[model samples]
Target: MTKISTFQVEDANTQIVDWLKIYAENAKVNGFVIGISGGVDSAVTSTLCAQTGLQVLCVEMPIHQAESHVTRGREHIDQLKIRYTNVNSIQADLTSVFDTFKSVVPHTSDILKVNLALANTRARLRMTTLYYFAGIQGLLVAGTGNKVEDFGVGFYTKYGDGGVDVSPIADLMKSEVFLLGKYLKVPESILTAAPTDGLFGDDRTDEDQLGASYDELEWAMLQDESKKSVEDFSGREKIVFEIYKRLNFVNRHKMIAIPVCKIKK
Candidate 1:
């Protein structure tokens, strides 16, 4: 298995900080707006942005989020010198939109589908909130997705988490993000906290939904890309491979650019 060394982590930190500065200056933006979920990805990304010496607005939008998650998010923000705001509109916004959907589609009966839709709605609401602040402040929204979730398994919401003006950690794998988080001196609570989307109220973790740990998933992804056959993998590796394949197929659309219709010549 490939491992990210300390030197690589430091280099990634430097590059990401440089990218943030260059992108903001070129776009003529005043600062960065990021949604902090208390996850390692957001923690690392926010820290990197803070290190850039640019104004960073860390907004915590919790929709039926666990108290622990919210606490951790607040804690991480406190550790940083950046500006932050807690937009506690989850209950009102999520309920209103969800009820509107139910009222509009009274015939819809699939519980799973409804739940998934509501979860996505929650994400979109957060995205909209971030953009609102960004627009008013002339700041760019910074996405916190890492390489594994953004490209390997495409685990982010379609225009929700995926909707951002800049992505700092999208090129680093999940494991690499953890390494960067440590190097950046992220709060220990946040660095060790289990990653979650905060969309599900019950506090199910990312691994709980993805059916595999980030390490296993990363391994499977690398092995798959290396063209290793299933016959070459052990039983556990095979299971990881299957999970990777299923998630990649299911979330492929999020990983690719939007399709455009071309006119016939």
Candidate 2:
């Protein structure tokens, strides 16, 4: 990956801000509303949206969230508020809502399936909350997903965090997002913290779930782009490459459009 100090990061920062401003202006919307997950992706994206000098509402929708995640999210929002007059934040604790939802839903016998469904449920609930705020406030929902997560592994819930009006950092890799986050003066806590979806309400990092770090995944993505076969590698490299391939295959549906059965015209 290229270093952070390159001119590309600066250009990307300016371009995204300009793109967002034009998008809002064209759509006749007020500004952007984004969820802050105490992660670098959200922090960087929200900051870029704020730089547009448009109203940027940073929403923290915590559903049985970890203490560190909550703290980092609050701190990032606070900093953005102090730095940008157009930036404001609100916290919507959804613990009760999630609990109520679980109570109403039928239980599954498989623990893994149950846990995965509940995790996705939490994300969808947050997405609904963001849209509620957007509809009332006339703002667009800005997504925090980066390149590796959004396209490489598809490490997001469909119609959940993946459903958004716009994605500000979707083109940049996780490493590049950190570089942009650093340039934007994002908090050290967030810049240093391991990346996690925070949807599972646990400290398990993305690596823990994906079986590969963002850096490793990034390399695998590049190798995949070159059309390298699994037979070309050995040991841990092979293992990581395989992990990347498996996720990309499994989540390809999330990355593509909903299939529409076409009536032959």
Candidate 3:
């Protein structure tokens, strides 16, 4: 396992807060907007923004989400005393969109593809909700993704959770984010809660979908090329490394900017 360090929390916090201040000022935005999904990432990100003493709006757009998820989200906002709003248009909005899609393409037989598309739609809807408030208030949409999910595995929806004006914790590993969350005094309930995207209505967790823990994934990501040879790893390590590589390949498009085609003059 990689020797995760706790030394960077203070420095990370200072850098993120400074980045937020400068970005918002330069953009001439009034505040920060974030979709609080009752996960540690959002909790820590929102708290960091609040620490900046900026008007941070934590919006909860629950779409067929579990009651516990909604409760945790609301609790975090109230605990922080940050400005917030709950847009409970989940059932109506999502149902309508799904119904329209079914009506338009009535013969789609691929259940997995359909399910994935709907899930991505949920994230995009939440993104739309965040931007709705951001637009009116002149705030930047703050993304809530850690390094492993955002870059290593690309475990976020493109133009959905990935669509944001500013990313405070994008550079920090999941472990580092937790340390920074503790340093920022984020609520214990939030810090200890299992992380989920809340896109799926069921109780699936981020780890469940990834097939490996964030720590394992991070370790795989940081493994030196000298360690890539099969002889260098144990059987279990090989399995984990394979999983990490597969996920990275599948989601690589999300990490890179769109490719542009230039016509030669």
Candidate 4:
């Protein structure tokens, strides 16, 4: 049997710090802008960016439905002493976007259309706020996606969370991300809590949507080189195959260079 423990966690602290410094110096940025969602990914990214000595402006944009969790997110961010802004993009800009889209996308269940549209609006508005701050403050938008989400499953929205100038941990897997978070001494409450994007109802979370535990997912993804091939498909292999196919299709656009037409001259 292939071992999941073979997935080693290396320290990217020095590299991340140097990268942020070079990016700031090259772009002449005064700081960085990040979205804090009370999740490990953003929290860890914000911390690393802050450690680089760049002024980190963290925005907590929450819907009325997710305010409590956002409140917790805010408290967690405060513990890190990162400069922060609480922008309620959901109830205002997000709601408006949903209403506009629903009027044209064919009448459907308000719950389904409203929820999906609202999620998209939330992502777009958050990016708008990030860029707005970046413009005013001369900051770069730092992305928080880990390797698993960025590569393994295309778990982000285009022009949404995917719209970042730099990704600090894009090469690290989910397990590696937790290791780095622990290495950075991030707070226990934020580190140990369930992973989520806070895009749904109060108790909603990412694992529930994926229909598998993070551990189970990671186990399936940690395929050994020797174990390659459909022959290796065994327990949980079906789950891995389904996930790989779905995310692979969903994120195909993210993996490509922008299409350009070439004319025969």
Task: Compare the candidates by lDDT and give the number of the best one.
Answer: 2
- Please give the distance, in angstroms, between residue 118's alpha carbon in candidate 2 and its true position after superposition: 0.2
Per-prediction TM-score: 0.91, 0.98, 0.89, 0.82
Candidate 3 global CA lDDT score: 0.79
Clashing pairs in 4: none
Candidate ordering by TM-score (highest first): 2, 1, 3, 4
Q: List candidate 3 segments past 4 Å from native.
A: 1-7, 82-107, 224-227
Cα-lDDT of candidate 2 = 0.93
TM-score of 1: 0.91
lDDT of each residue in 101-183, candidate 4, tens digit only: 54676545678776766676667777887888789878899999887677666777678888899999887777767777777
lDDT string, candidate 1, 1-265, tens digits: 5778999888888888998999899999888888888889888888888877777888877665788988888888887753333211121234455556657864457888878887887788888989988898888999998888988898888889999999999888888888888888888998888888878678688999899999999998898889886778778888889889888888898887789999999
Query: Candidate 4's error at 27, in angstroms?
Result: 1.1
What are the Cα lDDT values of the candidates?
0.82, 0.93, 0.79, 0.70
1-265 per-residue lDDT for model 3 (tens digits): 4433556667778888898988888888787888887888998888888877777777877777788887887777787774433211121235465456556864468888887888898888778878888898888899998888888888999999999988899988888887887887777887888877878788998889888888888888887333575456788788778888788889999988899998999
Candidates ranked by lDDT, best first? 2, 1, 3, 4
- Predict model 4's lDDT versus the native: 0.70
Largest TM-score belongs to which candidate? 2
Query: 1 or 4: which has the higher TM-score?
Result: 1
